[model samples]
Target: MARVALKGVRKDFGQTKVIHGVDLEVADGELVVIVGPSGCGKSTLLRMVAGLETVSAGEIAIDGRVVNQLEPKDRDIAMVFQNYALYPHMSVYDNMAYGLRNRGMAKDEIDRRVREAAKILELAALLERKPRQLSGGQRQRVAMGRAIVREPKAFLFDEPLSNLDAKLRVQMRVEIKKLQRQLGVTSLYVTHDQVEAMTLADRLVVMHAGIAEQIGTPLDLYARPASTFVGGFIGSPAMNFLPGHAENGTVEIGHGVSFALPGQAARGDVTVGIRPEHMTLNHGAGMATLPLKVDLLEPLGAETLVYGKLPDGLEVTARVHGETQVAIGSTLPFSVEPRHVHLFDKASGKRLP
Candidate 1:
């Protein structure tokens, strides 16, 4: 396994620039995920690394060798695509062996690699099945198996799990993580799903509108987001952002609704953010409190999400365990854990302090 590096990578379509400039590094044998919304240049970046697309500027190196000008095959990387990209007429063994055969590898060597990959993926029993005969999850595994048999320098997955059902997606996610750990390959995964990025990545690279927002370990980025976009994108239900003022290390919303900032900051206008799970609906007196009017209630098995709005028209979401008989239009108190509150510069959308 080898490291993958991107130095000021850029891409453009005719006169329009899609990817500005991105600098990223995937350590040897590490699994890194490139995540963002649609058209954020994640797939474009991956294609550039795979040699499928030309780099408008800068360099892409795999295993310390510049591969920007190398052919896709010569780059020694295998890509698992969103659609599985398997041949409908070929059997599982045939699909996994096609690349090796093209390279003119010995027949016995090709058989050994294919059989080993099939065993690793638990597809040895289904090697005779065609693509149509296999389930979505199974077909996706075959695609991964095909990449595994190549023993390439690196692996690229372009939303490979997008076509599976939700339940199977969760299951296959675990399988992919396990396979990567066993193989210990340098991999770059591109996905729009934040959940997949969080659960599968050893580290995450958050992108927005082609720019890299932040790159760090999952916990580091989640705990200390470099920008408001990272805070809002990394967590589910999103972060609740309210525009307010910072006065003497505290943020003032309205009418005695003041929250202590995480650290010292100059007095100015700032956006206060707090996660739904970090805030609770409590009727106690402390710090800051907002009287909320419940609008909706979502019961998610182990927990319930209470959606409401404050008197100042600020929307709030609070997470509570078990089912609470909270009704709509009911005004109740809500408060956030002080340390859990996040402060950011309203103008730049960057974290403050």
Candidate 2:
């Protein structure tokens, strides 16, 4: 329903800078998720947009209005916190309607919004229950319902699903995605969970050490990371990095293992990146093969993860079919397509073309 923009936005606690200059534009109805590990300034960025933290520099605009000088309540945005911030003594209905009442909205209009949000969240039957009588998921829904009744210009979520158990987190993930799509409200979500970011975001901002490392679709970041840090952070099971030297159109990893480059690259020391899923058991013409000394196997129903070391003591991981049988201390051949290989500058860790 609104467009949110941050231009060179920054935050500093006295002389200690936490958020470096960050510029982002969230188009109306698009969900942009900021994902990174702890202490990466993700939550700080979200709080800046919500007016909970003062901007050290730069501008934040919501619906085309500058809000750096505005209070949180005047920004017309709703925030859902990690801890379900609901009054324990209030019924679910009253909790959802509290904001509207504070603004002196009509009693009937408040009732209409509350019931509508409850029905959409499937919390209609539990409206009369207090926060103490609800499950964690239900309490989260009540928090969301509270935000929904406000119908704010934008929605800000600060790891709203972090408190739930694994199974419940997945369920709530689905619900949150559906609700966002159904409402078409512009949303900015911050989470350390890459899986959640991949599933819920239209676009992802991969942050690290107060910088936005890469901003793109999930698959784009997976296939072409700009830096080794982005490469290691964006994917599950992570990409395997091998030290190698490149020259004359080839890279020699070590211990007689070398492969032809798919394209021209900087002819020097580089890190070769290969996703675990990109390696396979079968070799094809022009494919590079590595002899893996199997150290462990993790059978995950549909697939298994193979953890091993190369002849030079470089560790590697490969994902293979679940039924594939292998034993510890056994050596196996793993093949990698040259096109799937990623090359990064060893000194800088930036991707090399």
Candidate 3:
């Protein structure tokens, strides 16, 4: 329903700057997820858009209207928080209808909206039940129903599924995605869970230390990360970094361990990045091999994680088939393709050409 945009958005607490200048646009009916570790300013950035926090600088616009001076209620946005935030004494119907009632809406219209939302959320049967009588998933549905009835211009979600169990989290995640698509509301979601971010977002903003490290589709960040931090953060097992020197179209990771570069790289000290999944046990033509002294093994059904150290004492991990047999203290050769290797500037930690 509405386009939300932030231009040079920033935040400051006293003299400390917690959010650097961040600019983003959430297109109408698009879902943009902001993901990062804790203290990365993701939540703060969402709060600024919702008018829950003051914009120390920059501008926030909703539906082409500047709202830096507006209050949260005037922003025409609904927020779903991590905590359920339900009223224990009030039944589900009343909880969903409370906001409309306060706005002095006609009783009949309020009833219609509440019942419609309840039906969509599959909470019609639980409308009379109090929050205390509902399961965690049911309670979360009620919260979502309450927000849906508002018909706001945009929706803001702050780690909405964090408090649920693992299984419930997955279930709720699917439901949220479906509901958002059905409603077609522009949404900005903040979460520390990368899996959720990758699955739910149309686009993702990866933040770090109050700065947005990269903004792109999930697969784009995974395949062609803009920096070492992004290379290490977006993937499941995380990319491994090794100190190396690059010169003459080749990189020497350690003494007597080197690989030819697929393309030109910075001509001096560089960090070599390799994804665990990219390493294989088979020695193929044009593949470079590294001697790994196995230190630990984790068997994960379909795949096993081999944790070990290279001959130079640098730690590395490899994801291998579960059936592969190996033991501690044994040295196994792991091979990597030259094209799968990544290079970064050692001093700046930025990806190199």
Q: Estimate every model's Cα lDDT from 0 to 1.
A: 0.91, 0.93, 0.92
In the range 1-353, model 2's lDDT, one tens digit per residue, is 79999999999999899999999999999999999999999999999999999999999999999999999999999999999899988999999999999989999999999999999999999999999999999999999999999999999999999999999999999999999999999999999999999999999999998989988988899899999999999888999999999998898888777888766656989999999998888888877789999999998999999999998888999999988898889999998988888999999999998
In model 3, the clashing pairs are none
Q: Clashes in model 2: which pairs?
A: none
Query: What is the lDDT, from 0 to 100, of the residue 232 in candidate 1?
Result: 93
**Cα lDDT for residue 119, candidate 1:** 90
Worst 10 residues of 1 by lDDT: 278-287
Query: What is the lDDT, from 0 to 100, of the residue 289 in candidate 1?
Result: 81
Each prediction's TM-score against the native? 0.97, 0.98, 0.96
In model 1, pairs of residues that clash are none
The Cα error of candidate 3 at residue 38, in Å, is 0.7
Q: Per-residue lDDT for 213-233 in model 3, tens only?
A: 999988888888889988988
Find the number of clashing residue pairs for candidate 3: 0
Question: Please, what are the lDDT tens digits per residue for candidate 1 over residues 1-353?
Answer: 89999999999999989899999999999999999999888999999999999999999999999998999999999999999999899999999999999999999999999999999899999999999999999999999999999999999999999999999999999999999999999999999999999999999999999899999988888888988999999988888888889988788888778987556665789888888887776644445887778999988978888889988888888887866677778987778767788888999999987
Local lDDT at 46 for model 1: 95
Candidates 1 and 2 compared by TM-score, better number: 2
Q: Show model 2 residue runs off by greater than 4 Å.
A: none
- When 2 and 3 are scored with lDDT, the better candidate is 2
